[model samples]
Target chain A: MPNATVAGITVDRNDEGFFTDPNQWTEAMAPELARSEGIDELTDDHWRVLKFMRSEYAQKGTGPTVRVLGKTSGVSIKELYQLFPKGPAKTAAKIAGIPKPRGCI
Target chain B: MTSRIVILGGGTGGTLTANRLRRLYGADEAAITVVDQDDRHVYQPGLLFVPFGLAHTDDIVRPRARQLHEGIEFIESAIDHVDIEAGEVRLGNGVTLGYDVLVVATGARLVPEETEGLLGPAWMDSVFTFYTPEGAAALGAALATFDRGRLVVNVVDMPIKCPVAPLEFCFLADWYFTERGIRDRVQITYATPLDGAFTKPIAAAQLGGMLNARGIEIVTEFNTGEVVPGGRLTGYDGREVQFDLAVVIPLHGGATYVGRSPGLGDELDFVPTDEHTLQSKAASNIFVIGDAANVPASKAGSVTHFEGETLVDNVRRFLTGEPLEAGFDGHANCFIETGFHKALLIDFNYDTEPVPGHYPSPVGLPLLKESRLNHLGKLLFQSVYWHGLLPGRDLPGLGSNMPTAGKHLPVPEKD
Candidate 1:
């Protein structure tokens, strides 16, 4: 039930920093979240992937799979790996201010 | 009147051994009964993936009794003791079943509490092990938020199941963090008691080189003493390593019941057997497989697969009053999953160490080298276990005896 304050915004986060409630996420917090993830800035490509993840989670209630990330987000798999080095699906889900992606990576 | 073969522990070792022996001996010839404390048979290799979120517990578990062939009777109950001399096993519920041939395949037991301060303050909160399903699942949550700081994979002791598993965790961690774009923020370290990254000298050199190239630090000969505060792991000799999150493989011991069956096991309760022939030194009629056998082989599933053929062949010889064949050769192989869709495999035996070569055939999958194709093979092994291995079907090209056709054995220097 813990929450984190980032970019002057309050949002619920677990000890591991995963969102306790996905609905609490805000687009304005993405940059600060990116900074926390060690990315100083989120470029157009990063936003493209992050937006796709957030939108999919909002619509279908599940994050995008890593397999379809590059194709759907218009980013190459190689480039996607470079964009989200921790893992495209899990890391992007975290930075997008959504719940941690589930299932086998 | 049929001979009863009571296999203790319905694990990889017991399941395959029972199935293979069942196929060799019909219902009239031998009756196979597998006894275990629980009916859940876990695909232990998948435990490594659970923490990384690459696998689900449901996907890896199956009813142990269901996995057994129709002929093999499965007893889902606790084992009070094994009357090895009396040739019968007593279940916790007071039932006794005698056996002409008893296979001690209970496998290894993880003794996490054996380590100091491991089960203390930080247990499962920060110090998690992927050896068990609960541990793996707990670590999965921990790994999700673990971004920066030292992520240490420590092997507290040796002779553990899947000896290379801890090393694999380190490699996968690197991959996991690298993908998150915060790889630079996190540091990876593999602290082990062994002299190098691996046991075999040849494979160790290559694997050690890989760890070095990946910027993963290797701390050798570290005998872990305790888990101190602030994520510092102190060794017995006062050496220390710090980690924000620690993945530790605890000490292993033989099944507790082995201690009850006097003279049936080693000091650690692991059955002492011929490394070449899995026949227990305690008794000729008793055989051992997988983690149960104190053979100089890896405690991996591949070892049990290889041991199956030899075990069944020996069972036939035993029943017919023939000498057991020493064909096992301590053959063992495992696929090391590296990050970035790549994996490395190593195959070796008692005398030979894993070196650069193609496995199975000279042109087969590359050995002692990392590749994506090998990664595919690693992923494919799960289905192979369910469909082929547990059923006792021999894989084509791959057999019990290790093949040397394409293996690059180093040449000895002449004086």
Candidate 2:
């Protein structure tokens, strides 16, 4: 598998499967990767947005625009930007492992 | 040359700070300029209630540029870098904005792909998150079709915006599924990396008891490793839980621009901010607030509200060559939804945890205990958020410092 490193952190191409298949992205794997990235804790707002992004992709087949995504998640656009400054399309897709998103790239 | 104040983001912190400054300083004294890539301003707290159909997506959004005071100039561009020594901010558009003072409120970012397999094929199929309006609507649709099986809500990592929201989702989900008459068919699970449901022990005990009473499964210290497709979550310990639908909270980091700005932020992009002063450790001229500051307080709207007062004062101090006010008490308050038409309220700061008592005064709304009044307070805050919070108006009796008068003191145990 081709490997990529972001800011010195190694990311394997096989890791793509981690987000692609719901069955493969297990709770056990999330923290290991997070720890490697140096994230030590999980907050409820983080889960709310991540879970919402997945559902949005499921029903709409695409991530919501930053505006819509923020509203749906109950996070104001200011707050959403505060939470995901890259915008919802990129951040949500990245976390959901859905690709760079069509318009974002 | 005109004295310049450069704000890195046009979100809550930037908007409020600019407006408040515009109110505090004459336009000629300080040329306030706010930079952001887009003009869309979202009502963030509304996202949590969207999936449950309590709020419409359109109701919570507005143009970013419109929210600012008349004197503030909005620059629509992404920040390429901040040259702190030169006292200038370089934009992606090639413009250099020089400033006498700067506010770094670019805030945090969510990176779900940081987790292995989280962004894969089944991302939106059986897995979801509601931090966005689109995610909420999609979750609403997914929940509509879900008839039965295990439903798990997991948090990947912390320091996210609104620390109580996921718990609210769990509580509301219980109400949502029950209303659909499919509550029994859906087994609800709450998983976290913490040893308890929350960080604060006292609040965790209270909330943990409520979850237990609701028959919702609580899986503590379950650090997630990956999301196995087909609804199973694998933990760091190799233990796996199967689910029909999985909700995930991904890892969050500070804005990318923070990394671009030398010595401005941490390895994770969060700014090395003074907890008490809200000033960036890298430079005295730079200040931070909201989700961007790496303070050990709950990253909620109330924290920003509290920080706003102290931050404004400190900025004033910085301009006047006065001693920077080290007055921020890490005060953070939030409303916790407990389902079945009730909610709980808690207020605390750095040295204190949430305790059961009345807030503001000894006889006011109950705190650290469930009541309908708190639930109404949560609902009312939405309106207050739009009208009161974003506008930089001070909420009556609710200031930056947490009032200790009405809170119940921790009971001492016999040694």
Candidate 3:
């Protein structure tokens, strides 16, 4: 784990830049993290996916996959890509300040 | 009074649990009954080889009752629901089975209808799934005639039983096509929801490299949304991968009866279990194993086999008013078939990822690397599963916990 400064506050992150301890994250940190992933602004759609991810992780001890976010987070799969490019589950999870999703091999 | 034990689903989990418990307790002390809907217990791992024409349904399929030990009772009936409050399992025929302890091992069910257009007009025609005996037989017939086209193996969602089977399908297809001298005419694609060829990083890199070498195109992070028969697969992210022949692994949920039972299942109907203890969170008297439990381990037979060791012991303790030992370590050992008479073996647990080494001992079968010996092991396992695993006989060196002696841990990356 390493300490990094984002949104003018220091937080613990893994080598992959995901928050190690999700409790250390705050809503204030989403903007700066979004910018790093090349999202210029955090729209309401983006927040919807992110908030669902955090709340799901809080309850399930794991972040939701892209399908779960698309199906239940009220975000369509097409729009999830536009909100978070490349990989929606991987990218949104990082910006949402949560650990990477765990799927069995 | 004798302790009454009722186990649900006489598949791998229930059979093994019943056999192990029978060996642990005499019939006078504990009366054990195993319930399942049908008599056939299809060796699930054999399903993978069926599509490749290496195995047949008759070879793998056996009567569920025949596999159990002499003393254990086997009941054939559809499970209706679990009356958790009353500690009873109600069957469809209004027969009620009261138990001092209940083990739910009904396993995951393939719900192809969960995906849009998966079970559409083209199903069993151009599109197929090899997860079931009929599906595998149908796929085998379809594959034999398939000479030239875009062949795609798509995994619809995660936590599917035998997570590596799709990759094996791709590998075997590559071998099958090459053997037919039409390898150049056919193009293969592997589409998965995971962002890599596998969940483990090292194994993914290795398996991904094999896919690249075999010229198998891999489309990652593709969550399948719809299946257009004989045309294309549309992902939730709106990415389309065209396919002439599609072998789709559909979304898996626990048995439907699980959903009907109160406090027994999650949204997906899998039992919410304490990963370490294999005890259902729904009640202390209930335990879960195999694909029925929502544990983070791969939903493979090896997991159920490993979990059996701890689960049976804990069941004994649970009956005696002793403290339940959190003995299960989520050890999963899998033999991955990479085609062309070669395969790879991986041994891992909840805490450790697959690493390069040998298993059981330093000189044992190689792990995370392909070898002919491993392929033989994979073939030999079918017999071992029927005789050794089902009978609850201990596999000398292989235990409930993962062995770390032979593994070579990856060197930390220099930042």
Candidate 4:
């Protein structure tokens, strides 16, 4: 089976439960995921932006551009960069548990 | 650090005020921050045109933050409460933002639950509202399938956003059914809480006559109590009006956070603001605008557009320790669509109701009379709202003050 590496954290492709059911993604695993990506701590703003990005992608079937994401989330571009640091499209997509958005390379 | 200017509710009022303030103050002097729960800035007026296929849902909506200036910060969090004495705002995420001046531009919310059985099993399938984007889209679908039936457009209560919208819906529904070759199959009824077709006597007479000529039934003084699915609309007086499809304007209230803040808003959750000054009655540094304000004026976008100029000036005064200027005179203007490629324009303020005259001048756009010229003006305003109104650009001769040039004033009877 192929494994998916999101922000340096590996998840087995056979783990259908976590992918299908968002409720299964617990907070205890958040720290481990963040640590794998070399992050220290997650702020309330970070969680808020991540949750919003995930829901938007689920509904629209497309990841938002930085402009659309910032506008819809009501977060400023500078603040988004400060939280993600690796760029909003990449970092937000990774944290949101979605596949990497297209054209990021 | 620069003085913090916090504006609540990033709808029409917050977006326009933030942009106008950015234009007025330099970045070093004042820092503007706008906070809203969500970012969808729906073009409310376009909701009226949606069901008639005049506008698609995408044409009217844009991201709320896209409308603001780059210097202004945007916060997407639910407002928990306002500490007026501390001059700080509390968010649901446990973050407190301090501000020197606050603008409560939080627009009104549609309280469908307020009306009994309005959100019951038949909601969105049989009954609907066009106020929200989702509601408008659903209503568009329902309208398309409605080839023949008793199509009833009812207003659940007053103080709704865009008071003329329900009337516009009726006119457009008439036009739509006719264009679909189902006018004979459809029976259109307009139910209102007012005694006449409209609030103003002269305008009501004019509009009521037009509705009658079009064969649209008018049901006045109807205080809608419940929407019984199998039954009909049960009024408070036990009167029932049966219909195959019901388009109801549910009760509207200010933001839920307004109710949470003590002494901040009225029973309707609307803030008690001085109609002229736009200052909140609860706090000196706070001001309210748009549909959130419990002022005696039409809750329409044009009112917010007119109030934008005065509100920016008052916010500046509040910061500099100067008295607020009483400039906003309940100025509201609306383009009343009368169907069949025609619309009517009305311009007035607190001291005046809609009077028959040319707007801006004695020979400009004719008011209170249907014309194709007004319909073009209505279409032109969508662009004006995006480029001019939201960006805080001034329109020529269209100031905050209501013009009295072309109106017909009643002369006092000689003794």
Best by DockQ: 3
Candidate 3 has an lDDT of 0.91
Query: CA lDDT, every prediction?
Result: 0.84, 0.77, 0.91, 0.82
Supply candidate 3's per-residue lDDT for B122.
91
Q: Considering just chain B, what TM-score does every model have?
A: 0.98, 0.97, 0.98, 0.98
| Pairwise DockQ winner, candidates 2 and 3 | 3
List the lowest-lDDT window of 10 residues for candidate 3 chain B: B406-415
User: Looking at candidate 2, what is the lDDT of residue A58?
Assistant: 70
lDDT by residue for model 4 (B47-155), tens:
8888777788898889999999889999999999988878899998899999898999998888899778999988998898988878888999888888878988899
What DockQ values do the models have? 0.01, 0.02, 0.50, 0.01
Model 2 agreement with the true structure over B1-415: per-residue lDDT tens digits: 4578998888788888888888888877889999998887777778877877778888888888988989899999988989989989999999999888899887778888877789888788888888777777788788878888898988865556777788888988899889888899889999876667777778889889988988899988565668887677886556687888888877777889888988888656878788899998889999998888877787777888789888988988998899998999999888887777888998999888889989988988899888999999988987887678877888888877889899888866533
- Candidate 4: which pairs clash? none
Show where candidate 2 strays beyond 4 Å.
A1-105, B411-415
Model 3, B192-216: lDDT tens digits are: 9887999988889999999999999
Q: Candidate 4: lDDT of B174?
A: 89
Pairs of residues at least 3 apart in sequence or in different chains that clash in candidate 1: A84-B179, A85-B178, A85-B179, A85-B180, A85-B181, A86-B179, A86-B180, A86-B181, A87-B179, A87-B180
**By DockQ thresholds, what CAPRI class is model 1?**
incorrect
The iRMS of the candidates, in order, is 20.8, 17.5, 3.3, 26.3
Consecutive 10-residue window with the lowest summed lDDT within model 2 chain B = B406-415
Model 1, span B1-415: residue lDDT tens: 5887889999898999888888888799898899999989899989989988899999999999888988888888888787777988888889999889888899999888777799998998889999999999999999999878888999886678988889889899888888888889999999987778987778889989989988999999676778986798987556799999999999888899898887787656788788787899899999999888877788889989999998888878987899889888878888999878999989988778888899988899899899999999999999999889998889987888888998888897543
Q: For residues A18-41, what per-residue lDDT tens digits would candidate 2 score against the true structure?
A: 233333333344444344434354
Q: What share of the true interface contacts does each candidate keep?
A: 0.00, 0.00, 0.54, 0.00
lDDT of 2 at B77: 98
